[model samples]
Target: MSTHVVVGVDGSVPATEAVEWAAADARRRGLDLRLVHVGPQWLHEGDAGHCARALEEAAGRARAVADGVKVTTEVLSGNVVEELIRESAAADALVLGSRGLGGFAGMMVGSVSLAVAGHAAGPVVVVRTAGAAGAAGASGHGTVVVGHDGSDDSRAAMEYAVEQARARHARLHVVSAWQLPVFSPYAVAYSGLVEDVVREEQAAARERVTPWRQANPDLVITDEQPCAHPVSALMDAAATADLVVVGSRGRGGFASAVLGSVGHGVLHHVTCPVAVVRPRQEDRA
Candidate 1:
């Protein structure tokens, strides 16, 4: 089956904004758009009409603004989380607003969006509403920011990031971060060793991305500082980037951990859209 992007909407302002963002991304990637509105199965029989109207409105707006992109809408009956995750299995990327109208009020992050971002097999994008909660109003609008940590999943995220950059004809900024050993703070003897380790990590991360830069000659790969805390570094880059990408699981996680710390942090903090990528099956084991 041809790949397409799926976006969940609830007829809220943020949800409509998310559809618009997903529509543009789908158009740029030459992918079709699927707009999903999930409701509880038989919760309120009369609610079906409301759901249909909302989805139809979203689809209409998507078609009007996103030219050349195939747009389709579905009003699904089931638990919202399960249905969205089900759709995610076949989607290239799942997109949603950071908060949902039915989930919470005046909250920066909603429960459903967090659940999908944590468990989706592929990448999941969380976009905030316009203003300070949304993508930064910074000068650089077409820049893509991706985080790397030398993990297999991170490599997968980088591959996706490169594709996104190429699709948007945008510059790619790769950021890698490393921390000093925990013992360094308490043991003066280990300070020098920690310093050496930090330097080694910095060099290794920089070297790890060298081939990616070489491979994507068409993308302007900007070298970013790799020594800051992973979350802070990525959030800083997001301040001006159009999108920020990270691996679903990082090097520090157990095999069963669904979402790594860095990915969760970026999802919560970045003003710009954040995509969390999972490594392929073969790469994970």
Candidate 2:
């Protein structure tokens, strides 16, 4: 299939970093890189060439970093998030920087990143700052971290994570989190049963991943069953990772509420690029 990676870049430091990351990623995957800049109507009246200038600068920056990759540029006029979502429908992935405004009520976590990741028809990656993802060429670097649970949504996430690890020759860290329900009717009775519940949950997670681990024998894999919240575990893993991967929605909990509050936390709070994977349109049907 025809595919390329689309990175939305504005003329900001974070956006520039995203362009570099996208270009590198595109080169690594042998795909084309498209730099997109969206401007409002007011920009046309005040500074018609603003979008052009931004795209030109971003394309040049990406070309410098990934010299051999095919690069293209685009300028769109309209609602930023809506236009991006539309653009993502035909791309392999939609990438965005970590910087965004808070003028809208629902744009809690870097508006465009969170909204597009939740509702887009494909994977949406929010690129983080360089320091947040650790220093360059350091030891124990560039691990691909993923949050996995025994859910179909999480399976898709793991699939993407494995592909990333294989492509980059990086270790895959699969983390599963467990927590006792605070509002259970037996809350008081099971106050001391948290460990028991966690053990069972960890076993289930391991069982789910066994087949995948056996299939990819050459890839280094680690299964972490942490007795903490999934977000907490994933964020900790992201601290020293090149990429953090997670499902667009999970089984039924904070993770399942990706379109709203939890989405903000996962995408905004993480220190590395976070890939929120969703099912393809054909698979969903």
131: Cα error in model 1, Å: 6.8
lDDT tens readout by residue for model 2, 18-119: 777778778777899988877774554444476677789989988887888899998777788898889888888888877743111133355667778888
TM-score of 2: 0.87
Instruction: Give per-model TM-scores.
Output: 0.88, 0.87
Q: All models: lDDT?
A: 0.75, 0.74
Candidate 1 residue lDDT tens string, 120-239: 777888887473222222234778898876677788889889988898778899887665546735677887787788777767777888899788888899866456578887888888
- Backbone clash count for every predicted candidate, in the order shown: 0, 0
lDDT of 1 at 256: 22
Q: Lowest-lDDT window of 10 residues in candidate 1?
A: 131-140
User: Where does the lowest 10-residue lDDT sum fall in candidate 2?
Assistant: 100-109
Best by lDDT: 1
